[model samples]
Each structure stands twice: as structure tokens, then as C-alpha cells.
Target: MALAWQGVRALARREWCSSWRQPAEWLTPLAFVIGVALMFPLGLGPEPARLRELAPGLLWIAALLASLLPLPRLFAADLADGSLEQWWLAPLPRPLAVALKLAVHWGWTGLPLVLLAPLLALAFGVDDAAPLALSLLLGTPVLTLLGGLGAALVLHARAGAGLLALLLLPLQVPVLVFGTAAAQGGNNAPVALLLLGAWLAVLLALAPWGIAATLSLMLD
Candidate 1:
């Protein structure tokens, strides 16, 4: 059990290291957060009060968009190198392997942005920072689950990562709606977070089987 988890961690680290070498992969998420947050002030004419009113909405949008940026390359590179096939051959349950991969993906991406939410909220004039931050925390895993689905689906894409964002963006609506609504005008973001967690649990349970079944059919 411990060894399986250790392998998962190692695989995730490899993904992280590979991505780190190609820094361009991060530009969209970083720019999207800063740019969208800045727009709140511009769109609301820089009135602190008005900016505060829209802060929760703006921050949630940024977080959602940021989380969406990495889905393409999340598994594409590994899949290209046959690492994904190696994972399939591991002695561990393939679903467990998929879950570990998702966990690692979340650890590298969503988890950091969640930790950075406070600064982003401030930039967007979010007076009630807790809600936006909490919303990000709860919602990012949902992004992972659903986004992982998108990532896995597109792992074989020849357009590479270019079309991934286009493919996955539409599927992110529910998370954004619930997440922003939770942060809109209040600090009670727990319910939305719960929903996100539930979504993640469902995906974690099902992703491996789905991926394995797809692979088996492809191999046949």
C-alpha cells in the first residue's frame, strides 16, 4: 500500500518536473488570474465599495479559469512517452493509479492556487475574502475530477495542448456556477465546497475504470 502511494507520488513528481521545464504552460493561468482580477477594478470604475461588491464574483472566475488552464498537458506528455501505459501495467488497481495521478495533478496545480487565493481576492477588492478563498478550496478538486476527465479524453490529441482548453472549458460550468454563487455576497461557502468534494469523490471512484476500459478497447 505504502509502495503504491510512493509510486504515485513519484509519477506525479515526474509530471511536475516535466511541466516546470516548459514554463509557458503556466502563463495562461497566471495571466488569467491577474488580468481578470484587474478588470474588476476597471469594470467597476475603481470605486472601492463597488469593487468589493463584485470581488467575490471576480475572484471565483479567476480561480475557475486558472484551474482550467492546465488540463491539456496534465497527462498528454506522459501519455506520449508511454508512462501512462506503464501505469496501466502496474500491479496496483488501475483506478487507484488514476486517482493517484489526479491527486498529484491537484497537488501541483489547484492546491497552490488555492493557497494563493487570499492575495488574488485582495487584488480584486474582495472584502469578504473567506468566501472566495473557501470557494476556491472546495471547487478546485472538482476542477481536477472533471478536468481530469477532459485531460484523459484528450490525451491522444494531435493538436497537442492547443485544443484542450477549448474542449474542457464548456464542461467547467457547474463548478463555476455553484462556486461563484457560494461566494456571492457572503462568507458561507461550505455547501458549495461540500458539493465539490462530492464531485471529486465520484470522479475518483470512476475515473480508473473509465480510463482502463477505454485503454482495453483501444488495445483490442
Candidate 2:
């Protein structure tokens, strides 16, 4: 048991270091999210009320789109360097390893979006940004987990990034709907947040195994 935990820690450390070194991999997605948020005011005119009305959906959409930028490469580096095979062969359970990787992926990619959501919300003229931030907090993990699954499914496909987006967007609609509703803030916000939490819990229980299975198929 101790040995298994040690392996998990080692893999976690390695993923953290690897991701830390690649600033662009994480930063680009954040930049994209910010860019999209900024563009809305310009395109839609500087009407605060209109922007505020649209803020929840626009922010969620921007976050969703930005998330795609980092996912295609989630396993690509490990695969190219043979690290994935080594990890697969190790004693650590593949699902645990996948879960750790997805968590780390969320740390770098999804967390930033969640953190920056409030600032983007403010820019969209949202007076109380808490709902937006809260919604993103609950929802981004689902995006990352689902995205990890899509990334694994398309790892060897031609134009894998685009394929990952296409495969994932449909699967992400529920999250999008609930997340946007939560962000919009009102009587419906609590219910929307609850649904997002439920979705996150379900995906947390299932996505790692799904990703691991897809990866096993790829490696074989």
C-alpha cells in the first residue's frame, strides 16, 4: 500500500514538474479565454446591461473553448517520450494514475480559468461575480475530466486536437448548460450549481477509468 502511494506521489511530482516547465501550454489557454471575453464587449458594443445579461453564457463558452487548447497535448508528451508506457507497466493502478494526471491537468489548465472567471465577469459588467466564480469552480473539473477522456480517445487520430474538440463538445453540453445557469445567478442558480456538482461527482467516479481504458487500448 505504501509502495502504491509512493508511485502515485512520484508520478504526481513528475507531472507537476513537466507541466510547470511548459508555461505556454497552460498560459495560452488563459490568454485565449481572456481574449474571447475581451472581444465580446467590443463586438457587442459597450452596453453594460447587455454584456451583463450575456456574461454568464459567454464566460462559460470562452472557458469551454479555452480548455480545448491544452487537452490534445495532455498525454502527447508522455506518449512521445515513452513515459506513458513505463507508467502503464508500473505497479500503480492505471485509473489512479489517470486521475492524478487529470487533477494535475486541472491545476494548470482548468484552475486558471476558474480563478480568472471573476475578473472576466467584472469586465462583462457583472456586479456580483460570486456566482460566476462559484459556477466555474464546480464546473471546470468536469470539463477537464471529460476532456481527458476525449484526449485519450483521440491520441492517435489524425488532427487529434480538432477531433478531441468535436468529440468533447457534445459530451460537455450538460456542464455548459448547468454552469451557465449557475453563473447567471438567481433563483435557479442554486439548482444549477447542485446539478453541476452532481455531474462533477459522477464524472469523478467514472472518467479516470474511462480514460485509462482508452489509453490501454491505444498502448496495445
lDDT of each: 0.71, 0.91
TM-score for every candidate vs. truth?
0.81, 0.97
Error of 1 at 175 (Å): 0.8
- Residue 131's lDDT within candidate 1 is 69
lDDT of 1 by residue, 1-220 (tens): 8877777677667766776786666656767787887766776696777777677666767777777677767776666678878886766777667777777667667776777777777876665567666777777777777777766666666774566678667877777877887766344556766776787677667766786665444444
Question: What TM-score does structure 2 among the candidates reach?
Answer: 0.97
The pairs that clash in candidate 1 are: none
lDDT (10s digit) by residue, model 2, range 87-203:
887779999999999899899988888788778987898888889989999999999999999899999998998788889999999899999999998899999999999999999
> How does model 2 fare in lDDT?
0.91
lDDT of 1 at 151: 68
Error of 2 at 130 (Å): 0.8
Question: Which consecutive 10 residues in model 1 have the weakest lDDT in total?
Answer: 211-220
